[model samples]
Target: MSLNSLASTIEGAQLVLRCKNLNDSINFLTTRLGFKVRMIMPSEAPTIAVLSAHGCTVRLEMVPNATPDAAHLRLLCKPALLPAGTPPRLSGPDGMVVDLVDAHAPVHVPPAVQEFVLTRLAGPESWGVGRAGMLYRDLIPSRLNGRFVASHILLPQGGPVPDYVHYHRVRFQVIFCKAGWVRLVYEDQGDPFVLQAGDCVLQPPEIRHRVLESSGGAEVVEIGCPAIHETHGDPGMHLPTGAWLPERSYDSQKFVRHVAAATPWGPSRLPGFEARDTGISAATEGLGGVRVLRPATGPANAAVESEALGAPGAHQGEFLFLFVLAGQCELGSTVLGQHALHAGDSCVLPAGADYRVSPAPGLELLEVTLPARLPA
Candidate 1:
């Protein structure tokens, strides 16, 4: 009944174009557009040519009188590929216009339009299908004006993930597991490892990895700089390259896997809570850091038993993200009124925005900040 309902049954897309001169059109598509011919009409003189390139297939039909749209093809590539003194727009012999543009461009982080944001799961609509059939719930819907993105991703029907070896072009990115477990493999990481609840991994830029499998209902929180970026596939590259290089650099950054089970609770800057450092600070050279904070209670918090834990430290940096992992807490600020957050809730406070967080006996949250250590 709706277009969304038809989405599952759809297979692929093919572009059909009528051309007055099929020979010239084929040559233009092949040479100018970088498309390769896949099929032809007859052995002697072909009237049609089926071409495929860049994940798209097109069929150029031979028609004596055909008035096609002005935009027959918009090729995204380096402008230098065109002849000297030629403009970006070109008219081929078939009367079709081709627009040339840049495809492999550098990452762009738009100017920050910062604002205080609070998000919670609304209903089933809050979840959308993403790559590898994972369900993604947008944590930062505003995307901080395209400067950053935080997503709550999950796999309801977890098993062998259909994901391939891939890498992203980003300035900063990390994944924190919130529930269940996921087995993943990374380049030169020795072997596949499982990431359990309350754990995290720092995915340096251009680090090739693959999602081998996951437990049912597995979920994670993903944060990255620059809301828009590219995910390039590395199908030919194999993981666990048999070399174990813990100090290897992936674009000036090292991969980190922080296991929660082995981490001990220690004094945190925020009062009334102890924190378990994820070691991301030292690994990233203070570019970013993560801490799992929980209110001090029982014998498990001996490390912070003697330390003075105060009210939530005023976040003093470029960014601050807080996600309620368990129990409940109230976030209040002089600018914004008080709001209670429960499990699965997330909030972001702008720079220099003084805020106070409510602490309960069972309260626990994950805090991520840029510049790992804030200035005093």
Candidate 2:
């Protein structure tokens, strides 16, 4: 797969820790708190440990050795790190090397506080390999034509992530809770929405909100129209102002109390979303606490004639995810080399990927499009 062509871009001013012995260091970090492994790259040789993590979706990656390929792995790993031997002051690609060095100089956050933070954040559904903090994960952003910004996020159970929201810009937020649940407090609306496991919530931009609290934390995969950072406004936005739903919410409290609580909301179950057109090989569909969409039929052959020079009529500039939930697909591409993608596999189409799918029944996918940046 093409690394640069992959969807998603990194965010700004986030934490990214890099080290030589990634596996062991990650193990230590996760054990301490506020970090969990989400995705891990496939490795056969015992010496190689190429992995990434979401420091709240700020990408962090590592390579076990300083081999040539590991260099590519290292560069690719740090969308943030700077060139080597360039004076520690000039470390990150961004102008923050000096700042990072200054921060690292003082390990001010006490170990107790770090552990406390870890207890509050939630875990993701697909915790790829590794234990806790050192788990493998990737942050694949969906940036179409270098304009629209779509980011994937993973929030680990942790300490206090104070309740707050951003006011600098507007955005349309679609959040999917794959595993665990969180309590959402909308300052404007007043009442907190107890989004349970498998539930989805759509919040309009500039809506003041934050996670009042969480139980077992929660794994939230959020896709938004236009991504703008969410920050707390002035002190005016605080608790007691937003209604906190303590009882209706189903969390560890429910099981602890022995109440028969059920999910209160879920994703849209559009009919055409799961159905394959024709000559398709396989398909899968699910709604409720989790959503999965996959192709039922195999890949379709390109007519290879008159339409070769132009874009498809109906869908233009739209991105698609060919997700393999069960089997594999023989992915052919002019740029990316040929490979077989198995279940839990995903590929992104920028302007779009032109490839024929092999007849496999269990490849599921979800197609998401951001609202036009400027009005259509």
Candidate 3:
């Protein structure tokens, strides 16, 4: 729990959509939206299509199967909880499909449009393997802080997670359960911590924490600071290192205690950790700083009358990365392609760019910030 290394922020999401016909979907995306398509899978049984248009961190996939009767489309649309009606409201009869757009450098999404996406995306059926049934909603990017942010992760039904850990080059993460329950097993500790919806844990840099995947599945919303690299140094060195701790047994309390003592959540909190009730404000936190905003204040709001986030028209920081972690927001400019960002969508801020963020009814956003460069 001690403030481990900085986590990675989510930059963007890979949206998988389905259509009555794969060829039609691909043609619409490429001809109308300016996206180029590639064949990830080729076979008459399950025709496959991939879209890796410019500026997209992930690709969009389209799979066709005559038997599933909308299984392929449902796979993509349901994850985001898209509406049940075929031909989503966004696109025409076939539904207007969009590729990835450069949300500045970070990511951003409007509230109203976000709900439109999630409404059709959510549900028990949308979750997938190793995915825990979670649909990424907001991908907030912070240039000042040098990482992106994400929230609203859903775990699918049917079982607990296998004992595994995540080691990423660009992402430092914190996973929180919004619904259901599960246990956390660390490599150094013998016992496991039970976490339910609303409870969150910070995985130290390179620290490997295991999720006891449940049979009924679980939903965990996670925040990651993408682009936060790990460093290696001699033992006892305080440099940022992301090494996974070897898994051990609970009976070995001595080893657990030893590691616990060295972490921020040690003696005081078991996992040296911190939480902030004020809510996430900027695009990045200063090096070695941790911010845990509560669910009440409601994510980050830019155009609040108080100018809570920033002046209505003020553009002060180096850059701003915005995303709709929960709910929705209404802001400047009409987002191209995907309409607006839902809980998992993200947008980047041009360096030193100025913009306003206003949350929609029930909408909340988490934005992180960092300086252009560290002081010498």
The lDDT leader among the candidates is 1
Top-down TM-score ranking: 1, 2, 3
Which wins on lDDT, candidate 2 or candidate 3?
3
Candidate 1: where are CA atoms >4 Å away?
1-104, 297-313
TM-score of each: 0.74, 0.40, 0.39
lDDT for each residue of candidate 1 in 164-206, tens digit (9 for 90 to 100): 7878788889999999999999998789999999999999988
Model 1 RMSD vs true structure: 12.3
RMSD of each: 12.3, 16.5, 18.4
Worst 10 residues of 2 by lDDT: 111-120
- The local lDDT score (0 to 100) that residue 310 gets in candidate 2 is 42
- Candidate 1's displacement at residue 112, Å, is 1.7
Alpha-carbon lDDT, every model: 0.77, 0.35, 0.37
Q: What lDDT tens digits, residue by residue, belong to model 2 across residues 80-185?
A: 3433333332243433342223211211211110000001112464344322222333223323222223323334555444334432122333455545656766
Instruction: Flag the better candidate by TM-score, 1 or 2.
Output: 1
Residue 347 lDDT in candidate 1: 93
